[model samples]
Target: MMIKPLLLAGALSIGLLSGCATDANRVPEITYEAAANSPFVATNYRAADALISQFRASPDGGPLIVATVVNIDALDQSSTLGRLISEQVSARFSQRGWAMVEMKFRSAVYMKRGEGELILTREIGEVARLNKAQAVILGSYGVSGTVVFINMKIVQPGSNIVVAAYDYVLPYNNEIRSMLVRSTR
Candidate 1:
């Protein structure tokens, strides 16, 4: 009788411990925020608007287009991040009445062959003139740790002079990376 009761008690204890283990070590659940509504994009849009305001107030302001937005991460200007930012910034600039230049021609002029880097050799102005744009918006962003530094400028095509410029810093996170990598849907 004693052995039967001891065995029963041991089995009960084992079942209780197993139940406790399941409840004690649950997997953590994480939900990432959306990229479109992220602080990074919001801050960049505001900076772009500010730069546009300054560009409009400048003497060489009419008929502008976003030429390029480069990602200086590893000095790569054609990265997914670069393209995403360029597309969004171009859209925003277009909404504000700035024209959109064809990327093929712009890339042919600015993007170095085989390196995928932007190299604006004094020929930038000539290319802009050919495109018939008075000014071109150039943008670049760099990531350091959990912060991203973004800079944008409106440059006079022929003189290569910056007529307007703006810079802003954003707190980087996974959502921002997702924004850079994924397309807007």
Candidate 2:
């Protein structure tokens, strides 16, 4: 009888201790918040817009297609960036009545993977005729240091000409503000 009661008491204590350790309510969780002060985001867009303006002033008039249709991240994000930039720039361009090739055109850009230089030029030529584009704008967002370098290149689609380029620095990348302002491209 003594052994039976002792065993029962021991089991109860073990069960209670384990129960407290494994309680669902005690699980930890994490949340992310944007920074209070940062200028990377604002600066980045400014740089991109400046590049666009320069292309408009030039006189190449090639395919007039601005797209990020290259296979970027290891997990193909072609459509996301392609549509995002194209549409965003396209909309901004539209506000001023500037002609731009609609992104609906299904042209693929392949540059041996991550080789944006070759692929960028390829896609410019592939886009169908709408309004001849004088330049093509492209951006890349992977950096090795604290400074994130986003590149925007304006190219002549038909002749594969690089009329203008913009490489903006985003050193102030925080959750609240991003430093992606327009700089010399």
Give the top-scoring candidate (TM-score): 1
State the lDDT at 185 in candidate 1.
17
For candidate 1, write residues 1-185 as lDDT tens digits.
79999999999999999999998898555447553455555665687678778874532344565644566554444445556565666777777666667555554465554323243536667766766778777777887889878788888878888889998876677656764564221
List candidate 1 stretches off by more than 4 Å.
1-36, 57-62, 71-78, 105-119, 177-185
Prediction 2 global C-alpha lDDT: 0.50
RMSD vs true structure, all candidates: 6.2, 8.9
Candidate 2 per-residue lDDT over residues 1-185, each given as its tens digit:
79999999999999999998888667354334433232433454565567666664633333355555332342233433333444555555555455665544433434333222234444556543334455566555543447544566766667776766776554524421222222111
> In angstroms, how far off is 123's CA in candidate 1?
3.3
- Candidate 1 has which clashing residue pairs, if any? none
TM-score of 1: 0.65
Error of 2 at 9 (Å): 26
TM-score for each of the candidates: 0.65, 0.49
Clashes of 2: 22
**For each candidate, how many residue pairs have backbone atoms clashing (under 3 Å)?**
0, 22
Worst 10 residues of 2 by lDDT: 176-185
